[model samples]
Target: MLSVESLSKSYGKKEIFKDISFSVQPGNIIGLVGENGAGKSTLLSILATLQSPEKGSIALFELDYKSKKREVRKHIAFVPQDIALWEDLTVEENMMFFEKLSWKKKGKEELKQLCSNVKLDRWNERVKTLSGGMKRKLNLAVSLIHDPELLLLDEPTAGIDLKSRKEIGNYLKKLALENGKMIIYTSHDMDEITNLCDQIICIGEDPFYQEILTETGKNILSF
Candidate 1:
């Protein structure tokens, strides 16, 4: 559902990626694994259309990101490593606001259901009062408000407890299995990738280090 071809990016004098290319099929969960400076996040950002690559192109569901940005964006959702939420708004209100922005309008019940789906139903309190995990759940819920076809999640389970991490992973797996949504996620946790991804992509300083699989099987990497 997503294709990235000849993707390369650099920050001033520092080069992160060169000719990085990959494709994600429908109903597949792709795990992006790499070291700290391996360009995982940069590649994701390019796919998310948040940052333009210095070279190469991205296409989502056949729509070229550079030429059909609006249409591509409608089918893509991005969940960043950091939680993005309105701290002062009540949990329900935050969900409602984003739902309206993304989906025109969503009933209270529907919003509540989404919250529940992400295990945030009990967090009806104001966002400022919720714990970090609660806020992360809120972030996940917001990303799904539009029912995007391609979901890009970056370090989504970072800093959360084991229980919440599992919940998030299970939720993502359900989305791919039940809804056939294409998922591309970046993570440092080997266990999460082992459990949730149908295929894994290991990126490093050299593009040769990257590998894609077709099953949830582990492959050891040699430096």
Candidate 2:
């Protein structure tokens, strides 16, 4: 559902990615890996339409990103590494706010169901009162209010407890396998990469590596 061609980015003399190209199809989970300061987040930001690359082209389902960002954004949801919640708002309030922003207007039951899916069960709890893991789950749930076709999660499971991490992993797997969402998430954990992704892509340097991690009973998403 996505194609990137010869993407390059730089800040003054320093460069990020150069000539990086890859494609991700529906039901595919792309695990992006690189060392710190490798521009993993930068790439995600470009894909999220928060920033434009110095040079390159991105196409989402054949729709050019540069010229069609508004249309492209409707089909994409981004969960960044940082917690993006109103500290004073109740969890349910946050969901409702984003729902309105997306103009999806999902009903209470559906929103709660999404929260349940992400293990954010306390609807009336304020954001500042939640644990780190719960906050991450809430961040994830907010992004899914519109059910975008492509999901970009930056360090989704980072800093969470083991149980919460596992919960996030299973939920993401279900999103790709059952709902056919194309997911690209960054992680420092190779185990998470092997367990969750259909492919592993290592960025931040030349000779970009994209390798299929498994061919077991997985439902491969054809490009």
Highest TM-score: which candidate? 2
Each candidate's lDDT (Cα)? 0.83, 0.86
Sequence-dependent TM-score of model 1: 0.90
lDDT of 2: 0.86
Segments of candidate 1 deviating more than 4 angstroms: 206-216, 219-223
Per-residue lDDT over 1-223 for candidate 2, one digit per residue giving the tens place of the 0 to 100 score: 8998888999899987788888999998998777778888898899899999999899999999989989999999999899998999999999988888884779989999999998889999999999999999999999999989999999999988999999999999999999999999999886787789887667744322223333333432221
**Top lDDT prediction, candidate number:** 2
* Candidate 2 segments whose C-alpha is farther than 4 A from its true place: 205-223
How do the residues 1-223 of candidate 1 rate in per-residue lDDT, one tens digit apiece? 7888888788999988788777788899988888889888987888888899999888887899999998888988899999898999999889888887885467889889989998887656999898788888899899988889999999998998999998889899999999999998999887788888877777774544344332434543322
Summing lDDT over every window of 10 consecutive residues in candidate 1, give the lowest-scoring window.
214-223
lDDT of 2 at 198: 83
TM-score of each: 0.90, 0.91
Candidate 2 has its poorest 10 consecutive residues by lDDT at 207-216
